[model samples]
Target: MSRNTTTHDEFSDRTILVTGSSRGIGAATAKELAERGGDVVVNYRTSEDRAEAVVDSITDAGGEAIAVQADVRDPDAVDELVATAESAFGTIDVLVNNANISFSRTPFLEHPWDEFRDKLVGEIRAAYNCTQAVTPGMLEHEYGRIVYVSSEATRTVRPGFSSHVVAKSALNGLARSVATELASEGVVANVISPGPVRTEASADVLEQFEDQLIAETPMGDLAEPRDVARTVALFASDDASFVTGTRTPVNGGLLVE
Candidate 1:
């Protein structure tokens, strides 16, 4: 790494895993962590090509990274994914719970039963799986940071976003509970709720809601994936060791008004 690059020994010996990191917020957060000197494990459920691409980008930029595949909804797969990261980098230091699948917005009355199962099971189950998998490693070392990528929809309460909002809210609750349980063990957990990030995933859902979102947001601008990624990095960094058990909203100052 060059002098211009920061390979902070702060995390040089650590492995940071970001789930669903093939693209979007997960990809951005993986890159950010890698750039800061942590060995990165990029976990993807299906996007092998994109995951490898992210790995290559990190390696090219003088950082170490490897792509792991797992359906986070499956507990066994998540355990394997964590084992792969441990085998690659020795110890897991930071785990970003970013593996989320978006379901179409539909009124609760019109929402299909399958969508509920898919959205709820996918989001909440994955969080539980990944956290459980990496937690032992954190406890062994007596140091860890867990960052959960959540949504502002929990606060926004968008009409058609019932499932996602509910799932994210549950995720935040989980983080809070874990923070209290794990703080005594030197582990800190926090949730980042980003509003209207302009990622490919968000593009599909934002078109219909951008106007309403922007009008409601105090900053009057859409957030970029990088914006949310930065906050994830912050929460995972030593700077936030004292911060935990709370919801941090990065919605361009939205939800305040």
Candidate 2:
């Protein structure tokens, strides 16, 4: 493959996988890394067109990228997804565990049992599945970067976001543990905790509460998907080689951590 036509070729030899990248932060991250010269694998559970569009955006810009379909919550599917990407480019050196997770805003008692269980189990399972699938090769190569996309809600839980808080809160611990365990082996792990982002999925919520959110944030604005993407790329790049086990917030100053 030709080297990515960007200013820096640091990622020209790297292969990255960003799950749930059909849109939002994941899509922006995939594009960001590709632009930095990495061959990127865009993973999505559904939304083929959106995923392909992400790939196209990269390739059109003279970067290498491909879209793969996989439900990261399933180990088998993750295995297949990693294998396919590896076959196409090479072993994945950077795994951005940005799998899509949702908040079912209901009081704990009112939350449906199945939805609660699914959201909780599904989030952790997806990260676990992808991590297990790619880390073996990363170990063999002696280099890896794992970034988890978490939420600022974990810090100060919202009234109706018990499940979301629980799930996201787990990621902070998981990332730290992974970093402690793998840092010696040349693998670095970190978390990006973003606040209410202005994306299609959150448009309704933002439409109703954007004014209040902006007022509360010192930055007086919401985070764009690309804002979180840039921070994720930093963790994935050599720039943050010494930055591990951190839950860096990309919330436009909404929360000071």
Candidate 3:
């Protein structure tokens, strides 16, 4: 048993692979996991340089990490990503489906087919491919955690984020179904919906409404990436073994029903 029952000792001896970890929520989540003693495989699509910086930060902090490049949109690339992580860390015990291209400012009418393709299809493919890739190892160990980084957009229906809302909503449904399918095998899948987190990607999207958002949120400010990452860290732990097939809202009372 780990000195911290916050999760389990399996995490100490385990590796977690986080997609799109070069920045934003992904980077924050990877750091949080590493801080908790998990070896981290930081996956990035383009920012190998940024990825290395994140890895260096983790190492500097006495955590183990490596940067792995994979365009999550490509199935073959995701397969290679799984192989690389397993090779580097011996096994992948957790998968954080955090790679996403933001569509916050693109309204439904203004959304181009290409932009929609880039956001929805890319995320869906990434989640499906990566989950499939990491499952065998998880099953062999009879334990795994898959946290899909979703958004509060599904609940609030942010007008300009139609594409993102649709895509993230699909992820919720995908998680529920997969959770049911995998629950018997000791694999858990869930979603963490963070309301308006303040990260490089969100700073641009929330610029105009930042003040209004703060006023509306009960927490009186936008969520930080670490807020959501901490939730991911919890879900990735055995502490949440009984939790699955549900969305864990990390929002600051923005869309509470």
Candidate 4:
């Protein structure tokens, strides 16, 4: 594990794939998992440099990781991603769906039909393809953990984010269905719905909504990416053995549900 491992080999001997891990929350999750003793595949569609940087950081800290480029929305690419990860680390035991979150800020009425459809389709398609590609291997091994990085926007309404919310909402259903159907197969699925997270690229967003979110949240600050990453690690850990088909909020107690 990396230097951050807290005396727990929580993910030892496990192989985890974190999609869109080149930056932000995804990168944090990849590093966190590696620190917890997982051999991680940092998957990215582009930003090879950033992806490599993530891998380098993990390895430099004595953790196992590799960077692989694959568009999770494409089934063929997802299949290849699974194969490559399995080739490197033997098999993937955990899958983190953190990509396909291109947010469009057009107002509901102004949103074009094609744009709306693409947003929803792209989001779900990526989940569908990755789930299909990884589950067979997971089932064959009789062990699997799938974590979807959803958004707090699904429940907390936000202007100009209708399509984004709708797409994220679909993941709730997907997580439920997958968890119910696969739990008996020794596989589990769940979600980590985060509120506005503070990341390197979120300055403009924070400038706009930080005060409002902080004022409403009991925790009084936006969650850092590591906070969400730690939750993802928890879901992927053996500690979450009895947890499945559930949505855990990492939103600083803003939406109490």
Candidate that scores best on TM-score: 4
- Lowest summed lDDT window (length 10), candidate 4: 1-10
Pick by TM-score: 2 or 3, better one: 2
lDDT of 1 by residue, 1-257 (tens): 11132344456777999999999999988988888888999999889999999999999999999999999988988878888888989879999999897787899999998997789878989999889988998999999999999988887786888999888888999999999999999999999988788898877678887898788877778887777887888899898999999788888777764
Lowest summed lDDT window (length 10), candidate 2: 1-10
Candidate 4: how large is its RMSD? Answer: 2.6
TM-score on alpha carbons, each prediction: 0.93, 0.95, 0.93, 0.96
Q: List the residue pairs that clash in candidate 1.
A: none
Question: What are the Cα lDDT values of the candidates?
Answer: 0.88, 0.89, 0.87, 0.91
For all candidates, what are the clash counts?
0, 0, 0, 0
lDDT of 1 at 114: 95
Candidate 1: list runs displaced more than 4 Å. Answer: 1-9
lDDT of 4 by residue, 52-84 (tens): 999999999999999999999889999899999
Arrange candidates by TM-score, descending.
4, 2, 3, 1
Using lDDT as the measure, name the better of candidate 2 and candidate 3: 2
Q: Write out the backbone clash pairs for model 3.
A: none
Candidate 3 root-mean-square deviation in Å: 3.7
Per-residue lDDT value at 182 in model 3: 96
lDDT of 3 by residue, 110-198 (tens): 87889887788877888999888999998998988999999888888867778888889888888898899999999999999998888
Q: How good is model 3 by TM-score?
A: 0.93
